[model samples]
Target chain A: MQLVDKDQVSKSLGGRLIRNNIMKFLFLLCTLVGLVVLVTLIVDTVLDGWNYLTWDFLTSFSSSRPENAGVYGAIIGSIWLMAVTAPVSIILSVGTAMYLEEYAPENRLTDFIKINISNLAGVPSVVFGLLGLTIFVRQLALGNSVLAAGLTLSLMILPVIVVSSQEAIRSVPSTVREASVGMGATKWQTVSRIILPAAIPGIITGIILALSRAIGETAPLVVLGVPVSLLVTPNSALDTFQALPMQIYNWVKMPQEEFQYLTAAGIIILLIILFLMNSVAIYIRNKFSKRY
Target chain B: MTDSQLKEDKNMGTEMGTEIGTEVKQADNASGIIESGQPVFQAKDFNLWYADNHALQNINLTFSENEISAIIGPSGCGKSTFIKALNRMVELVPIVRTEGHILYRGDNIFDKKMTVEELRTKVGMVFQNPNPFPKSIYDNVAYGARVHGIKKKKILDQIVEKSLRGAAIWDEVKDRLNQNAYGLSGGQQQRVCIARALAIEPDVILMDEPTSALDPISTTKIEDLIQQLSKDYSIVVVTHNMQQAARVSDKTAFFYQGYVVEHDDTSAIFENPKDKRTEDYVSGRFG
Candidate 1:
C-alpha cells in the first residue's frame, strides 16, 4: 500500500513545491502592485499638502487667492448632504430590501426586479445624477440645492444598500424562522423580533458603506450643478452648498500650484472621514457577531 | 418469514398485508382504536404535494393526548413532512400544497377561521439541529411568552424558570440565563430550544429528530425528558432511529414512500408488524 517511496515522495513534493511557490509569488507581486501605488499616493499627498493643512486653512472658506483658501464651507456642505442622504437612502433601501425578501411573492416578475436591481448597481453613477437632475431638480423644482444633490447621490447608492440589506436579511437562518413561527409568533413578530435584530449589524454596516460612497462621490453632485465653492455654510437642506469632493475637484483643476496642495489636503480630509465610518462599521459587526 | 415464504405470500395476493393486522389500527376507520386517552390530533385521508410531486399520500393517523407518538421512516419518506403538517408549518414552503383535512382537537386546521398564529400557539416544534436564537438564554426561553404579549418581567422570569426546569436543563443554565444561548454546548442549546417551545405552554409538541444531533448521554437525557413531558403534553417525534422510537414512544407509525404502512402500540408495531414493508424496515431488511 505504499504509493511511493520516501525519496520519490520527497522528489515529487519538491516539484509541486516549485509550482506552489511560483503561484504564491505571483499573487504576492500582484498584491504589492496595488499596495505600492496606494502607499505612494498617500505619502506623496502627505508630503505635498503637509504645509497647507493649517488651522487657518481649515477655518476659512475657499478664496480666489490660493493661500487663503480653505474647505470649511465644503466640510459643512458634505455634512449637510450626508444628513439628508443617510436617512433617506437607508430607509428607502432597507424597506425595499425587506419587502422584496420577506413579503414579495415568488414569481418571474420578482426575479426580474431583483436582477434589474443588481444590474442597476453597476450602472454608471453619473446617470443617476441625470435622473436626479430631471426629477428632483426640474420636476420637483428643488433647484441645485443640497436637497437636489443629496437625493441624486442617494439614488446612486440605492442599489448597493438594497443588495447588502437583502443579503443580511437572507443570511438569517431558516431554522430561526421556523422556531419563531412554531412558537406561534406572527410573521411580523418573527420579522421584527428575530430577523431584524440578527440583520441590523449587517444592515448598519451596509448603510455606513453606502454613505461613505455617497460622501466621496463628486461626479453626481457635479452633474447636479452644485457650486464649486460657497461663501457661507448651508443653514438649511434647501440652501446651496459645496461638498468635499467637489471642492477638491475644483481645486485640482485650478492653475494655482497651492490649489493642487489644497486638493491633496481635501483628499486627506475625505480619507479620514471614510476611515472613521469604516472603523465604526467593523466595530459594530465584531461586537454583534460575538453576541450571537 | 423466509424469502420463499414472502414470495408465496405475495403470490397468494395479500395486498401489502395492510388489511389484516393483529389489532384494530389507526389506518382503520374505527373511531375507538386508542384505548385510554382522547385523540388530540387526527389526519383523515390527508395528502400533500410539493408542486407536482406527491410528497404525502392518504396519511391516516391519530395522536392521543398525554402520550408520545413516534413517526419512524427512512430519509425523504415524509416523516418530517407529516409532523410539520400537524402544526401547519409545512405551508411555509412556497410550492407545498395539501389535500384533505388535519383535525386539531376535532377542528379542521385547514379552515380559514383557524388563523395560523392561533393554530401554532397550541402546537410547538423542536428542529433536528439546535437552533438557539442569538440572544440571552433568558430571552431565548422567554421568546414564546413574549410573542403572546406577556411583557411583565416578573411573569417572564417565572415562565423562563418553569420552561428551563421543564426541559430539565435549569440546573446547567440557571446561573447563565443572562449569557448568550449560543455560548452553551450543542446539547444544552437543544434543551434551550425545547424550553423555548415549552414556554408557550403548548398543548402538543412536535419534535423532528430532536436528538439526532446529540451525543448518547444527551439523547438519553432528552429521552427521559420526553417521558416526563408526556405526562403534561401530547408529543409526536419523527425519528430515523427505530430504537429511539421504540424506547421513547407509546405509539409508533411506520412510514414508507409517503404512506403510513403501519401504526399501532409501540411493542406490537415493532414485534408484530402486519405489513411486509414494515417488518422489512424494522428487521434491518431493505428500507
Candidate 2:
C-alpha cells in the first residue's frame, strides 16, 4: 500500500538540496569577493603605470627629480639579490626536505623539528628581518651588504620552500621508491635518479614561488637598513643592493604625483618578473611532470 | 585429469622427482636440498615482527632454481610480508625487525658482509600492483641497468629489447617503447613491470601477486609468462588465489596466522593437504 508513497522522503530530499545550493552560492560569493579585489588592484595599477613604464625609465638611474628617475639600479640589484637567493634557497630547502623525508629516522626529535619548521613558515617576515639584523648583519659582521640582505631574505622564505618541497617529495609514491631499491639502487642513487626526477616539478614550482615572494619582500631589507635609493647597481654578492619593492615603497611615500606614477611602474615591473618566473616554472612542470 | 594437467603434473615433479618425490618435504634441511642441484633461496626459521605484532613466525621454505613457487594465504596472513622480506624491502618499515637466516646460493643473505644492495640485485621483485616507473617504457625497463652503471646506449637498447621479449610483451609494446608506461592498459603495464624485472637479470624473482590486479585474460597471460620464465630464473610468487597458485606454481606454500601451514608440490597440497588449515583454505572454507 505504501509502495508509491514519496511525500516524506521527497520533501526532506528537496529541502536538503535547497540548503546545499544556498551554501554553494554563499561559498561562490566569498570566492568572487577575493577575485574582484585582485582584479580591481591589477586594473588600477595597469592604468596608472602604463605611461611611466618605459625602457628609458627602466635603464636610467634614480633621480631626486621624478622626471629623470629610473629603477635601473633597483632592477639590477633585484637581479643580483635573486642570483644569490635562488641557488641558496633551493639547495638548502631541497636538502632539508630530502633529509627529513628520506634519511632521518622517524622519531620524536624529527617530529619536533618538522613541527618547528612548519610553525616557522607562519612566523612574521619582520621577525626574520630582526634575526638577520642580529645574526648576519651584526653578529657575523656581514654588514648591510647584498649578502646580508640576500641571506636574510633566504631565511625569511626558507620555511616556505622547505614545507612545499617536503610535501612534493612526500607525495612521490612509495611504490617507485620500492621499485628502485628493489632493483638494488643505492640510497643516493635512488634519490638522484628516481626520487629527485619524480619530485622535480614540485621542487621547481616551490623554488619559483619562494623566489617570487622574496623578490617582492621589502620589510627585511628595510630593517637591514638597505638604502631607499641607490645610484649604482650591485655587482657582487657582498655589494649593497636595493630591490624593486623597496623602490616602490620609497616612491609611494613621496608627496609628488610623478613619484606616484613611478610607484605603479615599479609595481608593474615586479609583477612582470613574478609572472615570468611563474610562467617558466609552470611550463617546466607541464613538460616534465609525469601523471603517475 | 586432462592432457594439459598431466603435462603440468610432470613439470611439477621434475624438481621433486630426485628427492622427496614420494615423501613430504620437511620444514628444514632434511628436505631443503634437492638431489638435482642447489636451491636459489633457503629460508631457515625466518621470523619477522612489526613492533609487537608477529607478522611472520618461523617461515622455513626453499625455492628451487628455475621453478615457480607460489605462496597462498588469506588477507593479513603475512604472505606479502614474507615476499618483501626476500629482498629486504620490508626494512623500509620503521618498526620491522627480523630473526633467522635466509641463504642465497648457500650464503647467508643477512650477514653483515653481504649488503642489502647486493642482496636486492640478486632478488628482483614485482609488486601486487603494476608499478612501472612514470618514465617511458624504454626507460622503465632500463632503470635497473642504469643504476648498476651500464651507460652504453647500444647495450641498454639491446637489454631493453631482450627483456621485453623475455617478458613476452615485445610484440605489443615494441612500437611504443618511448611512450610513457602509465598510458598503457593495466595488463600492458604489468607486463612492462615484468620486463623491468627481467632486465636486471636477477637470480631470484619475487612476485607479490603479479596478476592480482589484472583481469582473467591478463592473469592467464602473466601466468604463461611466469611458466616460460621459470626455465631461466627462479620465481617466488605470493597470491591470494589458490587456483592461480595451483595453475602457475610447481609448489604451493600455504600460510595461516603468520605460519606456514604446509608447503608441498601443488598437486599434493591441492589433492591431499597434510594440515587441516591448508585443506580448509584450499577447499574454500574459512580463510
Candidate 3:
C-alpha cells in the first residue's frame, strides 16, 4: 500500500535545495544584467547631455555649432509623420485583423495569409525601406517627403499591428459573439458593438506599442533618405522631414565631440516619447481591464 | 405558429388553463404521449454533423408555447448543439452541416426566406456563463434593441427598465443602471444577460445551462424567474443538473449519444421513464 518504502533514500532534498538556489540566483543575475545596462545607459546619457537639454535647446533649430543645435525640426517632423502613420497603420491593421478573424473562411488561402502575416512581422525594417524606395519614393514619385516616410514606416509596422490586433480580437470571448448573434445582431453589428468595444483596450495598447517601435526606428528612415539636419519644420505631409533618431544618428557620426552630447539629448527625447506612449497604453489597459 | 398566429394566441387573453405554468397535457393514454397544444418549435427528424462526426441524430421533438422545456444529458450529448440549432446558430461553425427541417412557427428555418437574423430575433439565447457586454448594465440590456435599430435614448431606457424588471433584477440594479455590468456579481450579470435577451422581445428563449455557474441562491432565483417567464415566453433550457430540470421544466427530453431517448412530461420522464437509458440516467446509475 506504500507508494515509497521508508528505507528508500529520497532524491537528496539538500542537493535539490542547492540546485534551486543556484537557478534562482542565475535568473536574478540575468535580470540584473538588463537592469544594470538600462540604468547605466540612462545615467550616462543624463550626465553627458544635462547641459545641452535646455528649453532653448528644444526650441531652437539645429546648427553646425553643437552648443546652438536643437531638435525642434526633428520633433515636429516626427509628429507629422506620426499623424499620418498612426491612423493609417491602425485602420489598415484593424481591418485586416477583423477580416482574417471574423470573415475569412477556413481554407488553405486564409491559412497561407495568416502565416505570411506572422512571418512579415519578423522581416527587417530596412527591407521595408527598400520597398518604400521602389514603390512610394520612385514609382509613386512622392520623393523624400514626410508622406513617403510615413507610408514606409506604416508598412514596416503593419505586420506587428496586425498580429497584435488579431490577438486582441481573439481574446474577445466567442460567448459574447454568440450572445450578440443570438439576439439577432448582424455580423457587422456584433463586431462593432460587442467585439470591438471589448477588444479596444487591447487594440489601443498594441497600437501604442507599435507606434513606439516606429518612433525609435532609425534604419528605415535612414534608408528612406530623410534629411538628418533640416532647419525648417515639416508643416505639411509633402514637406521634407527629419526624425529624432535620424538626427541622433547624424550627430553621433559627426567629428565634433559636442555633437555626441546632442546625440545623447536626442536619445533622452526619444526615451521621453517612449515613456509617454507606454504610459498611455498602461492607463488604457488598467481602466478597461476593470470593466471586463 | 406565425407572427399572426402569435397575435391570435395573445388575443385568446390567457383564457385557456394552458396559458401559463398550469400543466395541460394532451395525452393519448394508449400511446402514453403527452403532447401540449400550440407547438412553438417542431424539429422533424433533424440531423446535424460536425464535419464527418454526427452530433445530433434524428431529433423529433416539439416545444409548446408558454412552457419551459428542459434538455438533460451528460457532457458531449449534443444538448447545447440541439438548442443552438433552434436559432440556426449552429451554422456559425464552419464544419457544421444539418439535414431535415427545424420548423419555427410552421416554417422551416432552413428556408431561403427565413434569414438567420430573423430567426434569432424571434428566438434569443442565454449562454451557460453570463456574458454581459463589458458596458453599463443599462447598455447591456439595451444592446439588443440598439442592434435592431432602436436608438432613441428614451426608448432604450424604457426597454432597459422593462427587461430588467422582466428578469426580476430591476430593483437591485435600478440605482446602478449606468454602472458597468462586470462590476455586478455573477448572478446579477446572468440576470443582465437574461434581460438582454428579453429586450428584443423574442417569443422563445434558448438557455444553455444558464445557472450552472451561479451559486445556489442565484440558481434558485433564476429558476423562479424562469418559471414566471414561461407564463409569457416559451423557454428551452439545457441543464446537466437533474434537480434543476425537475424544478423548472414542464417537459423534459433525455438525450443520450446525440439521440433523444425519451421525451415526455417532467413527471413521467422522472417518475416512470419508458426507456431503460432514461431510467438509469434519472436514477443516477449512469448518464
Backbone clashes under 3 angstroms, per model: 0, 0, 1
TM-score of chain B of each: 0.88, 0.87, 0.88
**Candidates 2 and 3: which is better by TM-score?**
2
C-alpha lDDT score of every prediction, in listed order: 0.89, 0.88, 0.89
TM agreement with the true structure for every prediction? 0.92, 0.92, 0.90
Clashing pairs in 3: B1-B105
Worst 10 residues of 1 chain B by lDDT: B20-29
Worst 10 residues of 2 chain A by lDDT: A1-10
Candidate 1 local lDDT, B1-287, one digit each (tens)? 69999899886654433333322233222322446498899999999999998999999888999888999988889999999999999988989999999999999999999998999999989999999989999999999999999999999999999999999999999898999999998899999999999999999999999999999678878888997898899999999877777777788999999999999888788878999899999886975
Instruction: Write candidate 3's Cα lDDT for B48-100 as tens digits.
Output: 99999999999999999887899999899999999989998889899999999
- Model 3 CA deviation exceeding 4 Å by range: A1-11, B1-35
Better of 1 and 3 by DockQ: 3
Model 3, span A208-284: residue lDDT tens? 99999999898888888898877788778998888888888889999999899889888999999999999999999
Q: Which scores higher on TM-score, 1 or 2?
A: 1
lDDT (Cα, tens digit) per residue for candidate 1, span A1-292: 9876998887799889999999999999999999999999999998988888889888889888888899999999999999999988998999999999988988899999999999999989889988998999999999999899988888889999999999999999888989999889988999999999899899989999989999999888888899986799988999999999999999999997878889888899899999999999999988776344
